[model samples]
Target: MATPNTAATPTFMVFATLRDDTDFAEFAALREDEQKQLEVLRSQGRIGAHYVSPARRATFVEVVAADEAEVAETLATLPFARFFDAEVYPTTPPDPAEIAHRARA
Candidate 1:
């Protein structure tokens, strides 16, 4: 049986950057395939918002997952996974009580 995961599950921001030596043609082809996969993941509620850097060299993708491992797994499915450096940052909602306390201070 699999061990239960008791840790907090959270959303994440995924940062991915193409390698400097990446082949443009190959990258374009892989990127097109990756986009199709992303659409499917989005429909499944695994992926959320997405953005591109102003220079269009890097991408930021939001993912809803159980942990960093899940985020990594999701990224590994991307066609460019082997050709890019990626990082995942977990996120949490701010406490409303804290916000109210700060407002009263």
Candidate 2:
């Protein structure tokens, strides 16, 4: 089960799948705007890594917010918001020390 987000646990992973009926032409038209908005979020530290798979029509974003609602709000700012069906999962970033230990093991 996913843990609830709190002040100390504000990171979230969002998986957004593109709707089947989404118009690709329209999405292409707004690509520039989407890129700009994503840049703004990154600059503000509201978003971290963003990965997209055009073949799978999916996007994964790392978000920093107070809760799921805030995460949703942040995503809604995207030009492609209407075209996505998103699932938000609260996350705790992996510990670097733990990763190093596991790697050495």
Candidate 3:
């Protein structure tokens, strides 16, 4: 059965294996694309919030997405995210953006 795209709510796991280490340029190319997607995600009314768990700069991640597939194909599958293996698991009241923002500071 095809999972319904909740559009408004669901967890999207974004993960990827390095297709090639020498592909450094690959990630650089999509830097702007990533920010654009974040804008799309917010404007589309998909995610209420989201966050990541970085394991040693690069590894497994658990992302909260409005749709599982959306996170993988759109966010995590991006060049910047292609380095880690990710899983999208349901999080009640998805992680707060404030926490991530504060962490950056």
Candidate 4:
């Protein structure tokens, strides 16, 4: 029998800097690859990922994990990990509902 995936208390944010020469079409393809990877991570308790684009020289990627180890493994597995300037940070994110709740408080 397999153990069910567990959720981590605090997630993580991973940042990736795209190569200077990266173009839109290329990153778009890369994004598809990333989505595939996320499916694997999701099975292992990954919360989600966030991606950002800058006018030039880098892209930022964020991955929310159940714990540090989960984040580390996910980062290592990313096809683009070695291609970009990458860093992982520990984080606690507010749920969207919580954010809405806070806005009203």
Q: What's the ranking of the predictions by lDDT, best on top?
A: 2, 1, 4, 3
Candidate 1: 10-residue stretch with minimal lDDT: 1-10
Best by lDDT: 2
**In model 3, how many backbone clashes occur?**
2
Which model is ahead, 2 or 4, in terms of lDDT?
Answer: 2
Query: Which pairs clash in model 4?
Result: 8-66, 18-59
Q: Write the per-residue lDDT of candidate 3 for residues 1-105, one digit (tens) a residue.
A: 223224234454333444445366766687698667666555544433444444433433334344566555555434466544555555454346644532342
Per-structure clash totals for the candidates = 0, 0, 2, 2
Which scores better on lDDT, 1 or 4? 1
Query: Using alpha carbons, what is the TM-score of model 3?
Result: 0.46
lDDT of 4 by residue, 71-99 (tens): 66667786666557767787666677644
Residue-wise lDDT of candidate 1 within 1-105, one digit each (tens)? 111212333568898887889898887777779889889777665676788884867889977677788888877777877877888888774256533533443
Task: Give each prediction's root-mean-square deviation over alpha carbons.
Answer: 7.5, 6.7, 7.3, 6.1
Would you list the rank order by TM-score, best first? 2, 1, 4, 3
| Native-to-model Cα distance after best TM-score fit, residue 67 in candidate 3, in Å | 5.7
The reply for model 1, stretches above 4 Å from the true place, is 1-9, 54-56, 94-105
